[model samples]
Target: MKFDCLIVDDEMELAETTCEYFNLFDVHTAFVTSAEACREFLREHEVSLLLLDINLGGTSGFQLCKELRLTTSIPILFISARSSEDDVLIALDIGGDDYIHKPYTLRVLLAKVKAVLKRWSNEPIPEEDGGLLQAGPVQIDTKLRRATLNGEPLKLKTMEYKLLHYLVQHKNRVIPKEELFSGVWGDIFAGDGTLNVHIRHLREKIEVSPKEPQLICTVWGIGYAFEGE
Candidate 1:
């Protein structure tokens, strides 16, 4: 009924092999070969996370991810051979949590998956001074694990929330990319592309004009800083 991970890939052999490897590591994984099968499987079982391939039979993983995001916020990691920056950006724009290129090492993939699972399963990081954190027009309720911009709720993904929380926690001070990786993601393996895309997403949600952001500013060659009123 409940699975730790599900691989939705048209490449049956690869999916099966990955599934086997995850299971061997006690991850409770499963595999589905098409968008339809993936939908059916989700209807019947609970999956903690998804490993989705961009190319699926008849329907692309992009389509499925967009559809799924309408209802679920579960972590979706896109696995594809398409290594172009465009594809990676598209995947993140369409609600994917992370992108993993093809020819991945099984152990590395497992470690990433385990890290995500741990983040979702555990409680939010406790704040020494627990309460609301305001940065300009945005308000972060650390206790409720929710954020609001201009009095309206901001629909943030798991990592987005973590990123914003960390930024607001140290408002007006530059936070290096390395510090963000360690503080928010709890792993330094995440690339700048991943962090940049998430920051763009956050800007799109909270800024009146995302093109000219006021709350979150980039300190070129350094990192980002959250400027509050």
Candidate 2:
């Protein structure tokens, strides 16, 4: 079955063009003009991925992304005119999988969509928090979407689980925030503060004191690393 996708954008021409391109490539694509419409589509249909515009008829993609995270963990790719570094970081922080600038090649976009769909919807849905991914007192169960500190269950948002999962999967090394954003959320625009918020949340859940985190440690101004002793 073809993976379903939704594009939320105010630019009708661009949205239609993208939808047409995806359809041509056999990725079931639907286009909408606002977050509200996207919301409706999500409820009535099954969408494997989302192409969200940061500015949709003056609506904030960041806010929409935050809302989407609360419901489904489906992949979200952002398309916007904003090219600022901070904007990109905020996109990632809010749970968007990737960011795309205007004037992008439709071919590249299609390739990215296929890759994301394949990864997030990998064959054989992993069991809830499937298997234990452990590091010191911290544990990540991908299938269950849960993390643990010592023996206690650590409350983790969908994005937090993904961020930590990516960090643990590449443990013992200091990874750049951009790379983490791209890899964990998908290679897209991630806002600067997004990772910080999730990291703080993760630390609060795992670290005895977030001020002195022992597991997910910072690599100065670079990014983060999962330290296992």
Best by TM-score: 1
Alpha-carbon RMSD of each model? 2.0, 4.3
Summarize candidate 1's per-residue lDDT along 59-144 as a digit string, tens digits.
99999999999989898999999999999999998899889999899999999898888877877768546578887888888888
**Window of ten residues with lowest summed lDDT in model 1:** 122-131
TM-score of 1: 0.90
> Tens digit of lDDT per residue, candidate 2, span 158-216?
66777877777677889998898677756454545556767877887777789998778
What TM-score, over all chains together, does every model reach?
0.90, 0.72
Give the count of colliding residue pairs in each prediction.
0, 19
Against the true structure, whose lDDT is highest?
A: 1
Evaluate all candidate structures by whole-model CA lDDT and list the values in order.
0.90, 0.79
Candidate 2 lDDT = 0.79
TM-score of 2: 0.72
